[model samples]
Target: MLIAQITDTHIKLPGKLAYKKVDTAAMLKRCVDELLTLDPQPDLILLTGDLVDLGRPAEYDHLKSILAPIRQRIIAIPGNHDDREAMRGAFHAEGYLPTEGKFLQFVVEDYPLRIVGLDTLIPGEGGGELCAERLEWLDRTLAQKPDVPTLVLMHHPPFITGIGHMDKIGLKGSDGFAAVMERHRHVELILCGHLHRTIHAQVGGRPAMTCPSPAHQVALDIDPEAPSCFTMEPPGFMLHWWNGRRLVTHTAVIGSYDGPHPFFDANGKLID
Candidate 1:
């Protein structure tokens, strides 16, 4: 099974560039185009949040239109910048959401893998939290299907990435979340977004990954004493492929850029 992950599109209304710079819409289109060209296309597209820059109806409309050409099953959740109600109104028509609740939480069970969407959005805050109710729901859901290979998807990562400023806004209830995952041995991977960069780590013995934003990426400076900011790095996404026993992840960078090509000689000597 193959899964495509896209995050942090941050679509702005009136189709304007974000942060007075990045042309997010164009970047997203490039990413989508790249995804469509892959052979053995992804079985499912897991969109891990900040789908819109401001969670406006128009922005969602634009997003829907941009995603229309994708033939794969697409699942999405909200992020700190999204308005839950607005997102529901826009996507509910597509029947992608299971409940009319504030959060988008559901399960996909038709494939060789069991996929679960968890809502970690916290209103008016950059940080994320899985409240008591959501925690209880997840705990019960995992217990109900103990034998299936499961992948949990959410907006915020539960592990720290040492990106100092971003880490400050990571999942707040990580301890409780870890406790729940510890009981579910069938969960093979935890997928997430919000960092705007591809990150991989292990949480409670299970592989956890964060997809890169299809738009702008957070600067890669690991400065522990500076303020949060973004960078001009080329946008990208992640593809997760599972073949029975192990899950493999690949990062695909999108958009036009220069440099990084190295020259070499037949004798393994640098010829640049």
Candidate 2:
């Protein structure tokens, strides 16, 4: 099965741009169109937070419209920039998010591979945390299907990326978080999106990745004291495929570029 992950959309109103620079709405539109053209098409979409520029209800409305192209099932979690209530109000039909609590944690049991989402949004804080309630839920949930291959989805990555400024706002409860994962060996991948770039790390002896934004990306500055900034890098999304045993992820970049030219001529001979 194929699962596509889109994150940090940060969609503003219909015509507004993010940070007075990147045209996030247009970028997302392009992303949606790209998603529609994939070969087998994704069976599910994981929207890993920062769906809007502001935590406004209208922003979620705009985000919803921007993401209307994909017809696959979607599961969304909140980022620091999202307002839980607004997201629920806008995407109530998806039914993955919570209805009663401030958290949006959930488990998708229908798929061949079990899917778990952890809500790491600490309201009004740039950095994310796995609070006591969230950690307990994760522990209990993973215990249910210890033998099934699973993917953990969240907004903030528990490990740190070298981008100094962004690292400051990284996940807070990583030590405890790692301990919980160590017990669940079936957890294969931990996917996240707050970093705004394609970053890879290992968490609890498994693969962890941060998906790139469909809009602006955080500058790749490893300087010890770099200021927080964004850039108009090639935007993209992550696609995870479960091949009945293991999970694999691919980065699909979005932009105006060249074609998939024929690598072979007449009889499918290798190109020189």
Candidate 3:
């Protein structure tokens, strides 16, 4: 099974620019088009968070239109920039996001791997947190499906990225979360977003990664005092392919680029 991951779109209403510069909607369109071009379309699309800039209903409407091209099943979680209620209403068609819950968490079991989404958003705040109740829920849920290969999804990364500005607003309660993760060996991958770059790390000895956005990216600033800033870096997404036993991830960049160069020049022999 193959799954595509796109995150931190930050799509605004029509004709609006994210951070007064990037055209996130257009970028998202390019990403959709690119996804459609794959040899076999992805079985599912995992949108990690920050789907919109201001958590507006209008933006969600536009977001729906932007993502309407791909026919694959989609699962999304909320980020700090998102409004849970509005997201619930926007994606009500999926019927997976719980309405009466304190956190928007769920497990999808229709595919080869079990998909678990953990909502780490804190309304009106940039930082993320996993409360005790939510942690308990995760522990219980993972315990219930110990034999199944699982993919844990969330909007906020549980580890700090050293990017000074973003770290201040990074996920809280990571140590506790890690403790819970250590007990769950079924977790194949812990996926996340919010940093807008391809970040790789290990959480509780399990591989974790943050997918890049379809638009702009946060500057790779390692300075301990760097201010909050973004960059016009090449945008991209992630493709997670489950080859029966293990998962392999490939990062896909947006836009038209060099040709799919031929390995052999009209011959089966080595090109060299």
Candidate 4:
């Protein structure tokens, strides 16, 4: 099974550039186009978060347009930048989210792997948290599906990435969250976003990864004292391929204008 992960598109209204800088809408369109061209198309698209710059109605409309060409099933959760009410209002008719709750949490059981969406959005806050109620729900849900290979999806990563400033704004209730995962042995992977770059770590023996945004990326500065900010680095996404027992991931960068292609042909011939 193949799962494509796209995060932090940050689409703006009327396809306008964000922060008077990055052309997010265009970049997302290019990413979608690239995904459509893949040989074995992704079975599902997991949108990790930050779908819009400000969660505006028009921004969602623009996002819908860019994603219309994607032929796979799409699942999404809200980020700190997203407004839950606004997201629900925009995607309610499409059935992209649950219809009965304040949080857009639900399960997808159609494939060999069971996928779950967790909401960690906190109103008026840059950081994320999984409250007690949500944790309880997760515990109950995992208990009910102990035998299935599960993939947990959320907007904020549940662990700290070495980037100190951003780490301060990561998931707040990580210890509590880890405790829940520790009990669910069937969980194969924990997928997330919010850091704007690809990150990998282990949480309770489960492989946890943060997908890179398709718009822009947070710089990879390891300084513990550095400030939090974004950079003009190339945007990308992750492709997770589940081959029966293990899940393998590959990162694909978007907007391919040109790059170095070093190669060596057979019989000791160098090709570039």
Candidate 5:
């Protein structure tokens, strides 16, 4: 099965751009157009977090309109920029998010890969944390179906990315999270967003990765005191393919570019 991962969309009001720079709305529309063109369309679409620039209801409305073209089911978690209650109300009809929980966490057992979405939003804080309650819930949930290959979705990546500024706002309680993963070997991958760029790491012996944004990417500066900034880098998303055994990921960059030149001639001879 193929799953498409789009994160950090940060959709704003209809006429606004993100940070007065990136045109997040337009970029997301382009990304959606690209997703619609995939040959074997993704079976599911996972929105890691930051669906809007702010947690406003109108922003959510705008986001919904932009993503209306997608027919596949979308599973989303909350990011630092998201408001839990706003998001819950916005997507309540979907029924994945719990009706009474303080967190927007949920599980999907309908597919071969069991999906476990974690809520890491810390309200007004720019950083995130998975407190003991959430950690225990994850442990208990994974214990329920030990045999099923699972995927954990959250907004903040657990590992410390070398990008200093971003790392400063990274997930707290990562050590505890790693410990939980150590006990659940069946967990296939941990999908996260918030970094706004492609990054990979291993936590508690499990693979974890962050997807790129559909608009701007966090500037790649790996210093202890890197400045906080973003760049108009090649926007992109990710495709995770589960071929019955393992999960493989590919970065799908957005926008138009060069041709699909062949390495060989029509007669099968190498082109010089």
Candidate 6:
């Protein structure tokens, strides 16, 4: 099975720009174009968070329209920029989101891999947290399918990324989340977003990572006092391929570029 991960889209209402510069909707359309053209297309798509810039209903409408070309089921969690109620109403028809919960968390058992999506959104705040309630729910949920290879999807990465500015707004209860992971060894990977750039770390010895956005990326500055900023870096997404036993990941960069150059000629001789 293959899964495509796209995050931090920050789609604003039609014709609006994110941060007064990036055209998130257009970028996302390009990313969607790339996804549609992939061979053996992804069986599923996961939107990690920040699907819109202001958590507005119209933005969700625009986002849905942009994502409409995708035929695969999409499972999305809320990022700090997302409003719980708005997102719930936007995707309620899909039926994965719990109808009466304060948090938008759910587990998907339809595929070969069990997927557990966690809500880390802290409304009107840039930071996120995994409070006791959410942590307990994750623990109990994982326990139910201990033998299944699972994928935990959360909007904020659980480890402190060296990018200090981003780290300050990182997940608050990471230690607790890690403790929960210690008991669920069946989790194959922890997929997260919000960093807007690819980052990887280990939580309770399990691999966890963040995917790049389809739009602007958090500038790669390493100082604690580094001013919060974003860059027009080459945007990308992630693909996780499960071959029955192990899950491998690859980063697929977007945009047209020079490619298909071969190291060998038609006769199989090295090109020199």
TM-score of each: 0.91, 0.96, 0.97, 0.94, 0.99, 0.99
Give the residue spans of candidate 5 off by over 4 A. none
Across 1-272, the per-residue lDDT of candidate 5 in tens digits comes to 99999999999989998888888999999999999999999999999999998899999999999999999999999999999888998999998999987899999999999999999999998899999999999999999999999999999999999989898999999999999999999999999999999999999999999999999999999897999999999999999999999999999999898988999999999999
lDDT string, candidate 3, 165-238, tens digits: 99899998899889988999889999999999999999988889899999999999998798999998899999
**Candidate maximizing lDDT:** 5
> Which window of 10 residues has the lowest lDDT sum in candidate 3?
262-271
Quick one: how many clashes does candidate 2 have?
0
Across residues 236-263, which tens digit of lDDT does each residue of candidate 4 receive? 9999999999899999988767656557
The per-model lDDT (C-alpha) reads 0.86, 0.88, 0.93, 0.88, 0.95, 0.95
Per-model tally of clashing residue pairs: 0, 0, 0, 0, 0, 0
Candidate 6 is scored at a TM of 0.99
Clashes of 4: 0
How many steric overlaps does candidate 3 have? 0
Candidate 4: the clashing residue pairs are none
* Model 2 spans with C-alpha error above 4 angstroms: 267-269
Tens digit per residue, CA lDDT, model 2, 1-272: 99999999998887787878888888889999999888999999989999887889998888888777778888888899998888888888777767788688899888998899898988899899998889999999999989889889999999978788888998989988999989999998999999899989888887899999988889989876889998888999989989997888889998778987888989999889
- Choose 4 or 5, whichever is better by lDDT: 5
Name the runs in model 6 displaced over 4 angstroms.
none
Q: Could you tell me which 10 consecutive residues in candidate 4 have the lowest summed lDDT? A: 256-265
Candidate 1, position 89, lDDT: 82
Question: Which residue pairs clash within candidate 2?
Answer: none
**Residue 242, model 5, lDDT:** 98
